[model samples]
Target: MQVNKRPYGYEEQTMFAIMAQILLIGFGLVNTGWTQTDFFPEETQLKTAFTNTPIEVCGRVVDQNGFPIENCIVCLTCGVATSTRADGTFILSNAIRSNQLLTVTALGFYPEIIPVELYLPTNRLAVELPPIILWPSNGNVIRFLFGGDTAFARRMLDPLERAARNEFPIENPDALISVSNPLPGTLRVVSYVKPFFLYVDYPIINFESVVTLDPSTPHWEKDYVYFTLPGSLPAIKTLNIDYVGLGNNHVYDYLESG
Candidate 1:
């Protein structure tokens, strides 16, 4: 038999080509299987499982002052709901995964809605949220009445003395003009303006007086004198005064005793 000579290294090259083809075919098969397994039914099932999983969410609701707002209705957009305790804390046991909204509602306060995104395989099933603050609601329009330099001392005492002696006429006096009364002559002095205070949502005053009964002497250094008796507290309450500004120069007229 005659032996035919082939090119140098031709057999080795042929073996390598065949092996490469086999590897390519095996890799294609593996890649196709992996793609289908990862992107099809299995992936869908995993996402569905994650979405259906329940989580616990806890948070607190408070006012602008950081005071707990009890009885606030805390709920998820998916219908899971709970009420805040006296301490303003609430918990949801079955909060669903994925993107969701957490809503907080309370009487006389603006409602708050927060977006939450929960994912799968978390180390902890419970989520603690930051404190939520709710602002007090002012209806369509808020009205405020402000007064200036409200003091019942010095010259103001003249009217009270006159009223006590029946020398000054007061209309619709709420009380007797006597020292024993809570506001004494204050009601008479404020009689004309009292109606305005009652009609507004907030009544504010520049309480230029130091409200105390320590019998402290006035600061003679200042030309103007301003001080009020503690008995005037009832007048403030009666006017529904929401704020009082004591930033004037005369606030320390009676020294620390004031």
Candidate 2:
């Protein structure tokens, strides 16, 4: 180092100032490319460290033996993660499109990443190495027919009451055939009185509560009369008339029960 010899006054001070300025300029060149504005331009700040387009991923994990791996943790770089269940399945929701790297890791297995395709949904994914497999969920539709209340009727109308009572058979033949029950089985015919047994001889001209005595040809008398149904119910019809019910409730004593 050499000392500058100058008068110890303004001249010496000026010499020291000039040397100091030269040293500062040399140091600036070593540290940075000296510029008046700044050593570096203004740094660009990242407004957001994330993306807007969200991604949805679903994947299945399995062991090396080709069996499902349950309760395995799955993670991604975009702060989205989930775990596999007993069926070795996991779903990653609300992930950014930029974060296509899906990290799948299972216990006692190697961690792996996969790229998300542009048009493919992560619903069904298969991993064949270190062994991992995926499958689609099973969906099915079902149909059921609902009608008739048998148990309710059976419970309300007890067995004892059902036995003692007589129900009018389904009056609507179409209803009986279509709704009640198919009627291709054996038919039950019932009638209160047979054709020959109906009391058709009670005449209004004869004395009430007494039969007039005709000693000559009693059975040949034509004075007796009674009304019968005009013709008959269609003979082709199968009637199921119970005699027990007919014998008990007889308000018309004029009509005899067969």
Off by over 4 Å in 1: 1-138, 159-182
Residue pairs of candidate 2 with colliding backbone atoms: 55-95
Q: What tens digits encode model 1's per-residue C-alpha lDDT throughout 122-222?
A: 44598889999987877855767799988776445444334332122233333333334437577777764665676557879998887765534667586
Per-residue alpha-carbon lDDT of model 2 for 1-258, expressed as tens digits? 999886589988999988888898877744545557633343212212223335566767876456888877777666778888888877777765552445666554544455554232333232222335432222232212221110112112132332211231222433212113322311211121122112112111111111111112212232332111111222113332112112222122123320
Candidate number with greatest TM-score: 1
| Model 2, residue 204: C-alpha shift (Å) | 99
Each model's RMSD to truth, in Å?
27.4, 41.2
lDDT value, candidate 2, whole model:
0.38
Off by over 4 Å in 2: 1-53, 118-258
Task: Quote each prediction's TM-score.
Answer: 0.38, 0.27
Q: Rate the local accuracy (lDDT) of all candidates.
A: 0.72, 0.38
Sequence-dependent TM-score of model 2: 0.27
* lDDT over C-alpha atoms for residue 217 of model 1: 62
In model 1, what are the clashing residue pairs, if there are any? none
